[model samples]
Target: MINNAPEVLRYAAFTTDPAGGNPAGVVLDATGLDAAAQLAIAAGLGYSETAFLTPGPTERSFAVRYFSPLAEVPFCGHATVATAVALADRIGPGELLFQTGAGPVPVSVTAGPDALEATLTSVEPHVLPIPQADVAEALTLLGWAAADLDPSLPARIAYAGARHLVLAAATRERLADLAYDFDGLARFMTDRDLTTLQLVWRESVGVFHVRNPFPVGGVVEDPATGAAAAAFGAYLRTLGETTPDAVLTLHQGHDLGRPGRLRVELRAGDARVRVTGAAVAIPADVA
Candidate 1:
């Protein structure tokens, strides 16, 4: 075992129940922990991602870094939400700024009916058209055909704090069946610096069922993805799919047996997207 490991707290983001959301390891005080140590802890924990927090320049702010099992990531939404809730539980609900690799992220935490809800405002988000050849390759690796895609949403690469391939499914059934070539997809994503594939199926106006294939993170899938949700919101905005000011509901992780809900908000004139979700601490033994 590693010597003097930093205390790693466990929390589940985007769900009130411990077993109903994405779990993330949170190092509340990683002042002296180096990248190797953080990566070790994250790898040992085997969560999709872990968050390391160090004091920032000002009060109520922290310099946070995220690590997957294999490598460090610029940003991770679920881990951010987990860290924010963990901090709120100790410091009381309020606003906190996170200095992340992607950029400075502002988060607000408030007590919800059942759990603490944290809202993270993403950096200015943008979308880019993915090459047809790349999309075709991705479809082949995913065992999906061109007809499986939803022409309304179109395929694009979206960036909020991290890059994600946004692909909408023509039907909920297509989105539900998510057996993809892990190794092939991982290689594909690594070459393109993609964090996850935001596979979605629109349920109704401003409501969607989403799933994230996160092979690049060394995880097969992410139960609740905040970054991808933010990216998806931006994608919708760029496509003129929703009103300037709109609230979207995303249902994710249900197929994985860890159902979670994310609330995505877009404001008029603001290029940033806001994602809100509840998080709860996981008991040590349970975690």
Candidate 2:
């Protein structure tokens, strides 16, 4: 329904540098754009995902939809953060609400020392066991063996907004060599309704290194993935790995050379996980 091309704002989420974090296309006002139009824009941009926003019932609430190059997804964490930071740049930092396919997400934007940061509180998250057969198939696609998996962190399907299969690598080297069967993994994920494979390695008690293989989203890998980080927090909590009020640090994108950091916080008595990160606008010429 859009007669003209809408202005798309590009921002890199989870990093202060425009080139560091995961790049997400943000359309602040996608009022008349239909699903096809939105998908076209997303595919043209060719980022991991893009977010479209329309006015909601409340003044500060918006109906948000996310799309990757290949398909529409339930939610996208990095896009949400990028959109919030972009809005804060225009309207100033404050609280905002986003109604998404997964559920209602409340985001708070605040001024940081270096740049504006946004924290989105996810809907209640849950973790479920992955069937051994499915896990074996995924491992085969990654060329990883059972012994390469860390015993401490068992494979599980975690969901905050989108679903991801959490796999822990026994060693950092194993996590870095990530060449995989692209088409096969894409088919595997599509069949099982998986968004990404969250491959992680713990550096310390509260610090971790992560990578997201997003074949289903038509990307080889995601530089920084906020939704997977949120789901990881829930997965850790369900495994009794951390305290109720644990604040975990996730380091991502180093392997791809676009380093980004994501902060995952678990509030006491609240099942919802909070992910905080900084975002910077990418110039149109370079975006």
Candidate 3:
């Protein structure tokens, strides 16, 4: 197969409306494309990330690779959702095992009257406290004062399929006004091997607002962040914050003018976190 773009299906995950969610490129079959080719394609597409799925007839699984414009990432939430929905178009909605760089991410697809929904089970997650100095530097880059942080959620680095630092803003206003030193923040995150800075503000017991600064991925702000959602689930578990059977609703990208929602489910017995979202194909000619 020629692997030249492969019809580049565009899908906005975590929202039914294309104008509301994070856009990702989905290449159903990319067996022949090498890493360099994939990177070139992703950069050409110009979305936050793209998911390339290699064909496998094993009934439930396939090797999946995620690439940003500048580099390859271990995992990406929106792209995974887009790929699962894209697969559902051909193979019918069910379960799928994705062998990603991070680990095996099991995705389950369910058909809705409106669109297809995908739920991805993240790899086992963990959280580590961020060093004070590191936190201070990050705060400085973000132009946020330490007093603006929410004491309840403390700063920590959370990992599910990838590593992300979770910083809680004390107020919604603080979360909305996101102006940061791009180069400085990128340097800090790169030095620590962090993927994105998961900035959040808790709205209620089970509802929160989030924004992700993905400088390392060459994006200013991620409209919808699936990886950060999984990592946040782990962070909550580590802190003993949410109820075992709670379903957390995360509203992201509203400030960026593209509103998206992510449903994060935490099971009492399962160590793997589940992140659910709806995905729809972006119209080909719309650009």
Candidate 4:
């Protein structure tokens, strides 16, 4: 048994700027830590989610778990990107496999001129239907009406690694104005097994802006959500809104003032989706 405290590494994923994007806590060596300890660490860090890693099947692999302040999630995309980039900074850019609670996720990291970037390929993705009554309740909690929704963009639940409810707003103004019943939404999400409500607005055919309300993770919002991005790509494909092979640009976190960008790439005949972004380590002392 190990007694020493595991070191926590902080990284902001989806942007080169430390202030942009979502910040995640990474524990590179948590083999000795129990779930309780991990939870405590995550609670201390106060990020939306923190990733814990142990040795996996191969030298370039790890068994990963994600924890929020309030609960444990099956997967977390921003945390995954943060962990991969942290590993790449130490071990050099290369391919990595993460054995997660949901499934195995393949990731590739590269050292770029600006910073280290990581791309994660999601497992097989699928879209599922949500009860209209539940959707209506969610809309009420979010203070949005049925008329505010985009008719062309159907609402559904999408899963790449974790489940997210996709709701498309008709206009950018509607998407930007975010006010919700936090406790009510959290209860609703818990009962429905949802991670976030992927509130989105299509700026153009291929360009979109998104905001994720992650009540289940004990966070009011997630600045950059890679899992949701992958799921969104699958959503668009399943809806026949985009070609099977195309690049999508997602701009998130701007309203929160921590601007971030996420790249979602879909390949022809491949059910899996890929989300890529840059990550940078944050200083412990700085708030």
Count: clashes, candidate 2: 0
TM-score, each model? 0.99, 0.98, 0.97, 0.98
Model 4: residue 40 alpha-carbon error in angstroms = 0.8
> Against the true structure, what is every candidate's RMSD?
0.8, 1.0, 1.5, 1.4
The CA lDDT at 265 in model 4 is 97
| Model 1 error, position 68 (Å) | 0.7
**Clashing residue pairs found in predicted model 1:** none
For candidate 3, which ten residues in a row score worst on lDDT? Answer: 1-10
For each candidate, what is the lDDT?
Answer: 0.96, 0.95, 0.92, 0.94
Output the better candidate (1/4) by lDDT.
Answer: 1
User: Where in model 4 is the C-alpha error above 4 Å?
Assistant: 1-3
Which runs of model 1 end up more than 4 angstroms from their true locations? none
After superposition on all CA atoms, how large is the RMSD of candidate 1? 0.8
Candidate 4: clashing pairs of residues: none
How many backbone clashes are present in model 3? 0
lDDT of 2 by residue, 1-287 (tens): 34788999899999998879899999999998999999999999999999999999988899999999999999999999999999999888999999999999999999988999999999899999989999999999999999999999999999999999999999999999999999999999999899999999999999999999999999999999999999999999999999999999999999998999999999998999999999999986654
lDDT tens digits, residue span 103-146, model 1: 99999999899999999999999999989999999999999999
